[model samples]
Target: MSAFVVAYFPHLCLAFGGLLVLCLSMARSVPAGFYPVTAGLFAALPGLWAVAGPQGGSPIACFYAGLLSVIALATIGLLARYAKRRGFAGDALYGLLLWSALGMLLLADADDWIMLAVGLELASLCLYALIAARLDDNLGTEAALKYFLPGAMALAVLLFGMALIYAASGSLEIAASLAAPGPLTAAGLALVLIGVGFKLSLAPVHLWTPDVYQGAPAPVAAFLSSGSKAAAAAALLHVCSEVSPEAKELLWPALAVAAGLTMAVGNLGAVAQGSVKRLLAYSSIAQMGYILMAAMAVNDGGGEAALFYLAAFALMDLAAFGAVGALSAEIGDRDDIAAYRGLGYVHPWRAGVLAIGLASLAGLPPTAGFVGKFLVFGAALSAGYVGLAAFGIITAVVGVFYALRLLAALYMRESLIAHPAAVYATGPAATLALGVMAAGLVGLGLFPQTLLGTIAALFGGA
Candidate 1:
């Protein structure tokens, strides 16, 4: 029990921390800045996994779980400022965030079917509520409904797939079930892929992402794009890595097609967006395609590439969305591209942070995103996925155009807003959080070896 608690300390903190925040809400007078402080504490609690005792969980899961915590902490930092301004920084929102983080951590460590199912539901439900937390916002509520209904269908399909796989293999372990070769297993894996595809916002099933991201609060969108998607990607990586060669042969072509389509759709979608949030939403979708492309080459260093990209992708989205959350106009988010004209002149620091994020997203040099792409493309080529790598490169170049559009809006154009001062200035806490993301992007880009080496070492690559 002691070891179990130690192993799952991060999980425990998220679960209990959520309840504690809800309890605190009943107090007559609570400390100012309490929620963010509490959130910071919860985020820090996961570090105890290394310090307090023996590590009890899979190292990969622990790493991903810790990453999720950081994402949640950053979301809260932005929320600390964004929510209050929008009149929705209730204790309930904070509590839900912790609980949702709990689910993400659970998914990171889930080695069996039931645990995976539970984590998926917990995370999805909490996300629905978080999206609609702004009771008065019709768009938020509508986005929640769109996500919730489709999500429910996806979960049902996933559970059914699990059932079929279990029946075929008589095993609950992810690897064991997937390793079984049969008609049942083939069908089951296909269904499961469909479910995961929807969850990950893959092309053809990604219709929900842009509207939802546009409707959800910017900070919540940040969490959705970064933490939730990272968790899903981690789980899918585990699934892909476990498949039998027969299973791989069955699903390989489908996955490759999806990867290409997702990249094309996402980049093309971004090019048409007039709203920054929608553009970021599309960009996030495109990043997932790159992950997929790298994942196909897991044996040839693609797993490490995917892991590095996931980490880099999360930081990039957080910085981008957090910047948007910080710079909302008098009424709400400045979603329109025209709204950000001359933002660099008015808020140099915030705009610069956004530029770093976009540059990274564009896979430009001296940014984490660029390093991530290099690793991904290298892995793809090493695995003999030459055509896919070339396609990804082309899509990446296309992706740069939209990011540059946003960058031009920030610095080149004159301020369109009459009262630049009226725009919500980012609070210190949120600014600091965005700074961390920007620094991480550049730091990882410049020193890619540390992370690449660490991932390789963890997976016994070197």
Candidate 2:
């Protein structure tokens, strides 16, 4: 019970913090930016503290709390510019974001059927409200509707699966249920996988990715990409790992198919996109394909590989999003690739940071992306999944072309259009983030032995 409370305190703190902020916001007309900013920071602190606590070193159950802490901080940090520029001034909005973050934390740690459902719903409801927070705009409302409808259906599917698992095992606990999942439990697990698959944007169930990513604000998209998706993947990995070894055979094929198809579809779809936002949308889907492959690599050191890649993936993504935030602010929210033409010449610092980020995403040398992919590829080789591993490497090579294309545009001949003198200030926070991410990427790439050693110690054989 103490362990449970210790593990669960972050969620409780978030709930309390959100409610307090809500009450305070309603009491008076605070400064336009005060509510959300304060709430966001306050909300993040609990999770940070929790993750850094003594018990965060759990082995097999994974770093459920700590991973979430990194995610919370990253998401909040990525949204700094977006929140600042948009003037998300309400207490409600901040409270919602905080609450949602807590919910994500809970979802990652869910070990019981009821807890999973509750946590997921908590996060989903907050997101629905957050999406619709764009006051006086029907478009935001429409996006929220699109998000909610499918989200609700997904939730229903998840709940039904949970119920079926419970019925088969006569236990709500994940460990007990996994001891022997009969046909009913297997079916239920499949349904739950579908539900989580939706959250992570795994096809053929990922129809909502483009709409949600495209329609949502930049920060929201970042949050969805990092926090929400990370939590869902964490939960899925936990559940699948806990299930019977025999059941894993049943699961891997589905995940493998989903991974391969999503990678091909996402990358191919991204090829023609002019909007950076849309391009990133497809990029995220492709990234998820890699993540899914790592997940499916359970027997073949998949778990360790997945964990390694997730850390690297989070860093690269946040860096990328940070660049986009700065770039968007520089050009009045112009997300078109055309606006990025010759960006290297005009905004050298931003372009450099973005280049580093793209390089990592492309899995090029001397970046965290390379190390992460190497770990996964090594795992695949060790597992003897030669074909799957080859496919991943090939796709990674293809990704290099698109990533280089961005760099080419940035550095190619300067655009004739007058460059804006006042580039969005890559203010202190952005600079700090970019620097930290850049150093980490380079450090990990060059001296991967240290990172790999840590990963092996933490996850046992990476």
Highest-scoring model, TM-score: 1
Alpha-carbon runs more than 4 Å astray in model 2 = 1-5, 29-37, 40-64, 136-139, 449-455, 459-462
| Candidate lDDT values, in order | 0.86, 0.74
Give per-residue CA lDDT, model 1, range 1-462, as digits (tens). 987877778888888998898888888598747977886788668755533322767767766865776798799889988888778878778888888888887776789989888988899999999999999999999999989999999899999999999999999999888877988998898888788778789988899999999999999999989988898888888888888888888888999999999999999899999999999999999999999888788866799889999999999999998888777744246689998888887778888899999999989999999999999999999988899889999999999999999999999998766644545667888988999999999999999998787676656677
Cα TM-score per model: 0.97, 0.90
Evaluate residue 294 in candidate 2 and report its C-alpha lDDT on the 0 to 100 scale: 74
Worst 10 residues of 2 by lDDT: 53-62
Candidate 2 contains a number of clashing pairs equal to: 1
lDDT measured at residue 101 in model 2 versus the true structure, 0 to 100: 78
Cα distance off (Å), candidate 2, residue 240: 1.8
Tell me, by lDDT, which candidate is best: 1
Q: What lDDT is obtained when candidate 1 is compared to the true structure?
A: 0.86
